[model samples]
Target: MRCLYCHAVIHEEMSWSDLLFKRIEDPFCGICKSGLLEIKKENSCSVCSGKMEGSGTCGDCLIWNEHQMYHDVLHSNRSLYEYNQLLKEMIKRFKYNGDYAVAGCFRKKIIEEVKKLPRQTLLVPVPVSEERLQTRGFNQTEALLVMAGLKFECLLTRKNEEVSQAKKLKHDRHSGENPFKAIQQLNGENILLMDDLYTTGTTIRRAAHILKEAGAGEVRSLTIGR
Candidate 1:
């Protein structure tokens, strides 16, 4: 196989089996598999689906606070992929199909995004309710952070087990009634809020509000898909 990005010839080889019952070399190539790994590009806004012009924040995002009440404290947010067919499928499989291994693919993209920001920023992933955690065995946002080798704390909490926000319409997704509470104080801290996707600004806005109320110095968000 040839690498899509570099067009390198990937050599194949076999490895010994670990099981005691039997042993056989498998047909796989280390170089090709590594090369074929998907690379995520810094594309556009997940919330408004606008083009990102190296500002990290989109033009539509500049007016997000006008529609929402939390503008006074929230600083900005960023996402790596447009929430289109490819991203939707990737998120679905990561969330429901038990394809946890793919989290590393997003991890690479998100880490690149964070690197573009100033160093030493604290990462705060949106918290999943205990009920959902029990069923899913992991929070997809947290998994992405772990894979990215970023530092973060679980300071925010879901107020209740609300309906799957993913299925809601964009306007409904931002309705003010959905509440996120801060269980801990992050006073004077710069934070990077992380999530799986950004359909609307509601969830991140709620989180930014609570973080600012808790004395967070600056609040920005990062997600896998728009």
Candidate 2:
């Protein structure tokens, strides 16, 4: 096999488990794999999974928890990887440049995490605006879930085409009118929002607020990056 990211040959020293049982293997070769940094849950914020200097909440989560409106709107978030330079470049190429094959690099991790969520939890992929969907030729968030072979609901819709979340500053992200609207009334169901990135986490928090107001029981998130 070959590295999914760099297309380099992957050499393996087979262990007995490989012959005896079905064991998942790393998709990328050592050099490429080294570039992907996973967040250590023990040293991360309990709410948003941001890296912590100690064993408590990070400053960003602290601010969100303190906000009267935003507090508890998003129950929690679990990010699989840190937004390192290598992942950034891969995301740029996959999301913006239309290199769909790059999605394979993240498939293993996404599948592993989804399997860990409660069986009854509703999986929802954060929707892109119609304009963005047209421009990009695919909703990247939806594509991530689809590529992982996981089922998700289109529960929310982007109300308008405005500035892309990537272009917005922290203040701008917090100031925007709630762009998401629930497609159907939820009945206190546990929800897990799926997205590609979590910066200040303004995006998912807004989505969670809409879902919570519509009666979702617990609104948490699973993001590929933090």
Query: lDDT, candidate 2, residue 143?
Result: 83
lDDT of 2 by residue, 86-160 (tens): 989989998999987777677888888878877689999999898988888988888888877788899999965
What stretches of model 1 exceed 4 Å from their correct place?
1-49, 52-63
How far in Å is the alpha carbon of 190 misplaced in model 1?
A: 0.5
- Candidate with top lDDT is 2
10 residues in a row with least lDDT, candidate 2: 159-168
* TM-score for each model: 0.72, 0.94
Best by TM-score: 2
Q: TM-score for model 1?
A: 0.72
Pairs of residues clashing in candidate 2: none
For model 1, residues 1-226, the per-residue Cα lDDT tens digits are 5432234555654344445444322212354334332323345443344465442556556677576466655565566655666556667777888777667655556766788776677888898878788878898989988876787888888855667776778777766474678878765888889988766677888888888888888788886666
TM-score of model 2 (CA atoms) = 0.94
